[model samples]
Target: MSRDEQLRRAAYEEMEKHKDVVEKDPYRLHYHLMPTVGLLNDPNGFIQFKGTYHVYYQWMPFKTGHGAKFWGHYSSNDFVNWTHEEIALTPSEWYEKNGCYSGSAIEHDGKIYAYYTGNVKDEEGNRETYQCLAISEESLHFDKRGPVVHLPDGFTAHFRDPKVWEQDGAFFMVVGAQTRELKGAVALFRSDDLENWDYQGVLTGGGEGRLADFGYMFECPDLFPLGERDILIFSPQGIEASGMKYQNVYQAGYVAGQFDSATGTFEHGEFEELDRGFDFYAPQTTLDDKGRRILFAWMSVPDQNEQDHPTIEHKWLHTMTLPRELKLVDGKVRQVPLEEMEDLRVGPAIQVNVELNRETRVLKAVKGKAFEMEITDLSMTEGWFDLTVGDGIRFVYSSGEQTVTLERKSYVNGVVEKRQCSVKQLNSLRVFVDTSSIEVFVNEGEETFTARFYPSPNNDTVRFETSHQAVFTIRKWDLKHVNLK
Candidate 1:
């Protein structure tokens, strides 16, 4: 047997030994992709091949920290039901002796081609990166073909996370990079075949003046066309906080702009954050067979609240956000829950209209840890309104101020932390609650807030209160469990 196969089997054996302990962690998500053991980081190599959707993530099966990562695999026919696959890539090659970092997947000439970063360090502790490729015909087992694209000029070893796609008869790859001068940027490359690549140039950098620019180093770059323009999605590190934005140590946002293929430059607009919440980063997308752009993000931010997570005692760490279908409307991307999710709704939705007037709260079968809720036709006279989910999280909106806030009990300092954004008006709200996470879609996806918090699993109460008169209609649906077997 190959050394890669040996490492993969040994990791699976470790997972088997910890299954009972990990399963006992109440924070384990019911319908999200999480590591069987150890840590799960960025969503890597996401694609839909031959009508089967495959999601490969960064996994370290030995502990709950960022270490040598293996690609954990999950497959789904519809986004609603998923089946876990074997470990995809193991750190067994000389170029990737340390780890196989984040990358993307594309189907080329009747085979599934996986492009990723090979992270290795020499004995003297120097870093080296290789833009590598592997191919599989049946999408079951892969044969490593080694590096297809070498490191180009001006960029350091931080250049990784290659997102590949085919456009106009040629393949284009966008990779996160940092120049030797320490400026963060996304570099562009072109290829007629996946084997040979030509570095075009840095598309943009992290200075305040350029398009798609902000941060010390960019990571996980994805560039694709949406609506009438193209969107470059990336996670930028080293951005200082601007009001309620950039609160996390890293930020995952995008620049909506036009890409000139002839000149290999992207002229874009401002950087808008994709999610306004505490626990979202490193998002990736793929166009499904149905022509809809579907996205999945690693549900935890790096170097923030990770140590405070309660799941580490059980030998697991994080999850992926529920699959969201993306649509570009009015020059902004809108994310709606996948329509296939309705397959998991248990019963008829319970609907009611609640009128608030300086009262504490009220509830009637409107609370659950795993359910969906929609509020619409909002009417308010004055003052702010709040809805408390579980014991540690709350959602507040003030129509008088045109602001919405998501507050959580800080795992960092055990105090309240909030992320606030202006919404112009409170048209409606759609919220999804799972075991340890909440995702809110505002105004038909004009804005979104995603968060993960560990409230007492037994406490599933949702309550609403207001300081003045207000009225809103609420519909709640209890979601059925999809066994992750």
Candidate 2:
């Protein structure tokens, strides 16, 4: 067999070896996308081509750690039912011998083109980076075209993750980079055709403009226009904790700006974090046929508590968050769960409107391993409100402090950890509870908290408590598992 075929066979064998063990894990997500075996991270090649949605991710099939990644593929016509496609790309060639890192996909002239980073390391441990391309005429089998863009000047080999878009009959690409002086940056490039690319100057970061000396490195840079303003989203490493922001090990945030495509200049605003919870990084967005910007992010952070995840015991790790629709609301990006997600709702919703003052209630019908809960028309007369799901996962909103907090038991040690964000008022909340995860959307997505919790499978109780007189309506529906085959 050829090298590519040999590598593919090895990956298939690895999956077959661990498939039963991974499936038996109680922490496996019921509705989220996870690797069949080994590890999965970074949603790449997310696009809608020929009326079908395709999502490709970074996968390492042989082990539950980062290594030479294969492009795992999945497709859906209605966005609710997903069909696992064949493996899209494998790191068997000379350019991507080490790994095929993250990138994006674009459709041009009836063909789909994917751009990704070719991560290479020599025997001496020196690194070489290349921006590679793979074309798919039918959105299934990909033809690797090798590296189209090499490492540019003044940047280290930490450069990768090319996000490409078409503007005025020309293609523009944004790449995450680190300067030779070790400053995070986003470099721009232009391509007349898909093969040859010309380097433009740095668009932001690297002490070039207002955002000077932000972080040590930037990864998975995505640039797109939402409404009248352009939004640039990237994950930055080496940013220290600042008050309630940058609390995670690495941060994924965005800047609202205007990009002058002719001059390759970006004038932007301050960086704002996309998600306020743990386990959200490497977010990738795609514009569908209906003119909606939908996003899916890796539900686990790098170098945080990866080793402690209970799923690692079952030979698999990490998953993708639920699809979210992005809208520019009031000068900020608001993320709401996709409307198609409602298709997963099974049976009638259990509805309740209650007034509580220094009371706690546990409705028997509002408990499940996987469900969707929405709290609306909330009005509190005084103190705080708390909602505890499963074992130790708690959501609290303090009126006096004007803050929302999510507390969960740490997977590494049993210590309770909390992540908080400031909110002026708590008007509404939409929470999605899966087998091993919780995604909380506060006040119509002004702020979001995405997390993974490993509570006992039998403990599915959801409790509500209030310190003051608070009136709110709660509606919950059990969600059915999406067909993943």
Candidate 3:
């Protein structure tokens, strides 16, 4: 066998040895694709090709830490149900000897083309990167195309995560880059045959010195046309906490503005954090054949210590959030769960449209780990309302103060705890309740809190109490049972 074949077989053998432990992991989600073992980060090569949605991720199969990265593949017919495919590309080939890092996928004619970043470290341990390509005519078996485009000038080796799309009979790509001066920026390139690329120029850069540096280098830069505006999403590494945003160790956010393909320059405004949570990064977008832009985020962030994760004992490191539909409305983007999730509603959901009486309402007829609730405010003298979801977990939406705060007591069974995000207004609220988590999206994605809770199954009751007379329209849907892959 060739050396590449030997390395592939060895990596596959390592993954096979841990199958039992991976399957027995207790922290696995019911529906999301998780690492059977080791660390999984950065949703790479996300695309819907040949009628199936393919999602590849950064995987290190041997241990629960980031080491010897490879591309792990999973496909879905409905986006809700996923099937694990064979490993797409291991770091066995000469081009990707160190690791095959994050990149996007594209469907050309009838074949699926995967473009990723190849990592190589020389004897001195100096890092070298190449934006590489591989193709799969059958969508399962792949043919390595080798490194199609070498790194252009005026940038450091921090360049990676290529996002490609077709426009006006030509293909375009945006890569996260850092200048020799250590400034964060994104580089744009144009291609016709997907082999040779012409470097355009710096798409965005030099905002507020290195502090607004967000990071010394922006990783996973994604730019796609959304409705009337263009959205550029990236992971900025060195952002400091100025006020409400950028409080996390790292920030995965987007800047909305206009893109000029002719000049390869994007003039965008301030960056907005996509998901205000403990875990969110390297988000990528793909437009379905129908033209709707859908997004998936890396649900695990690099925070605290590797061993501090509660799910470490389970062997896997991370999972992705539910698929969300992105719609640009009135210049801002709004994210809502796809309609396919509605099929998860099992029992008859009870939705009440009523006028408030200033008194608390305690309804014990319904309770579950997976549920969706939509609350619409009709009119209220007092703007504050409390949504109590068992125990001391209270979601306070104060319209008068224009802030929404989520407070939890004994949250996540004392395993994980957090108090994050403040949204404005109480007009409309959607709450997703999971077995050990609660995700609240206020005013249609204006602000979101992806958080965890650990209450007894018996205490899953949802109650509502108000400060004054306020009319409300409540719609509830019990999510379909998920057999988490």
Candidate 3 achieves a global lDDT of 0.76
Model 3: lDDT of residue 344: 61
The runs of at least 3 residues in candidate 2 whose Cα sits more than 4 Å from the true structure, single-residue gaps closed, are none
Instruction: Write model 3 residue lDDT over 1-485, tens digit each, in one string.
Output: 87667756776787678777666644445555577677888888888888888889899877778755888888888877778888888887777888898999999979888899998888898888889999998667778888887888878888889999888788899998887878788889999998889988778873442224556788899898888889999988777777557766788888899888767667777788887755677888888877778888877567634455556666667777667788887777778776676666677778887665767777655455578888876567776777788664678766677667677664334543344566544678888776555667778777666644445546768877777777888888777656645
RMSD of 2: 0.8
* Candidates ranked by lDDT: 2, 1, 3
lDDT of each: 0.88, 0.92, 0.76
| Strongest candidate by TM-score | 2
Candidate 1 has an lDDT of: 0.88
Clashes of 2: 0
Compared with the true structure, what per-residue lDDT tens digits does model 2 show for residues 169-250?
Answer: 7899999999999999999999898788999989999866766879989899999999989999999998999998999999
lDDT score, candidate 3, position 290: 73
- Selected candidate, larger TM-score, 2 vs 3: 2
Selected candidate, larger lDDT, 1 vs 2: 2
- At residue 425, give the lDDT of candidate 1: 83
